[model samples]
Target: MDFDPLPDKPAPDNPSGKLVLLRHGETEWSRAGKHTGLTDVPLTPHGEELARNAGPLLSGYDFVLELCSPLERARRTAELAGLHPEIDPLLVEWDYGGYEGRTTKEIRKELGYNWTPFTHGVIRGENSPGETVEEVAGRASRVLTRVLPAMAEGDVAIVAHGHLLRILTSVFLRMAPRFGAALTLDAGSISVLAFYREEPAILTWNHGPGLPLKPSES
Candidate 1:
């Protein structure tokens, strides 16, 4: 259970604690390949099992600030994972808007060509207007401002959706938010963002329950 993968910081006193991301477990929409932004979705029974198991993987870290999206799926995952997290509205998923409940394949078929949320973009929805990738990046920046300080204090964990966390990872790495489209996160996965000598780096990514790092890799 040695989780010592992080490298040394450039400075001793200014060490920033790692940012641990916990993606919420599966919901009906997620299982069905539907876009699940803004709409509140509950976790499936198997999803609850996934959350409970994720708790053990995170038992090593002393998280100072634990945040979860206000969405039910994210909050329920945090709760089941034994995290008493503060509900952070900013951690909600990408505002899929017009595409809220539709799958990417379905959208593409309807449009008669390829349509991607990150690249092709989303229009205003029936309930609320969708957010552009850059807008999501802006929100990610604000979240960093709030969490970076806490990271310096101690490790921080966020329980949220796939798109939101991936976009946040891109922002943290100083990349275009749309770069998140290249990253894929599954339900009930863990990703760690820590410093590599004071510069941001991804320590581990998309570590799902079924995957394991080889001994030498760890």
Candidate 2:
């Protein structure tokens, strides 16, 4: 809850701060390539293992603020990762609306054309009323407003969903929300955002525990 107010403009020299972004472990829906928004799903056993393994990767950092989505998946991932994070609704995943339980392939089969959440958006349905890319970007901006101040103190960690985190990163870099389409975040992966030469930059991205590293790098 404690964070600094957003400055009208960033300082020219020192970096603003670092943000450590993490996507929750895999869920049945995620494994099936279904759009999961506002759905409360638990992680698979393998997913739990993924989260546990991520602990050591994050244990060394000193975070001033730690937050996670209220969804069970994100909260559980944080716990498994050895982090006690506050719940932040703003960190929830994109509202997929009518596409809630469907995959792009299924949707395409129905629509007779390729469909993507990033460009076409979602149709408002009884079960799921989808959100626009711009709307998602707006929420991402609000999240930055809260975390930027905390970043001034030290690093901050946000455990959230794949789509939301990517959009958040795009907003962090002052890029269009659609640009998030280019960033692929795997389940239980960690990405780091920091300042380079006093400008926002990605220090590391989509690093999974299973990734191979050279002896010296490891």
Candidate 3:
């Protein structure tokens, strides 16, 4: 077969990147509504199944890189998702500090202050175990800035915690991280961010096993 040496092909149009953001599956803490941060817990058996199912659902994408939080839950979920992920600290969930392993209601009762990441931010003692909403947002922004360059031409999967991923989505769209408070990301759910001419667009939002895989196809 004879092939002609073609001239440069416009450098492939400077392809914009796609982000395949995946929230980790359920954990005992998650099921109990506890704030999971550095606590590092494993998924429930059902969560494991859900994570495994993600493989077939997500395998079709040509992801250039796979990243996951250093936390065990996120790491295990990434493993079950069938993607070998490179650990990135930026992908770690928000550090709940004193709130770790505790529920929102419990924290409110103890502190006498309504606490929420988007609302009150972190309440009390800020030594080293927890993170404020702004702190978490900064981490999300750092990851976003670093990953965007690598996203060109193909997709990138990031297996992480719900709160952090939500913040990341907001940051990627150039929105305030506090807006993530409005978003509800379920365990093992998948979201996608597409770029059109360097502009951010949500190709898909929170979706998972029972939902239609693609919007048009849905």
Query: What does the lDDT read for residue 51 in candidate 2?
Result: 89
Compose the digit string of candidate 2's lDDT tens values, residues 1-218: 11222343563334456799988887888878888888898998877888888899998788999999999999999999999999988888888887887888889999998878887888886876778878878887888877877887888999999999988888887777888988888888999998776677899999989943221100
Considering TM-score, which of the candidate structures 1 and 2 is the better prediction for this target? Answer: 2
Candidates ranked by TM-score, best first? 2, 1, 3
The positional error of residue 138 in candidate 2, measured at the CA in angstroms, is 0.9
Mind sharing the TM-score for model 3?
A: 0.85
In the order shown, the candidates' Cα RMSDs to the true structure are 7.3, 5.7, 9.8
Candidate 3 yields a Cα-based lDDT of 0.75
Candidate 1 lDDT, tens digit per residue, 84-173? 999889899989889989888888989998888888889898788998888877777778777877887899999998999988898787
The C-alpha stretches of model 3 lying farther than 4 A from their native spots are 1-14, 124-129, 211-218
| Candidate 1 ranges with C-alpha deviation above 4 Å | 1-14, 211-218
lDDT of 1 at 124: 97
- RMSD (Cα, Å) of model 3: 9.8
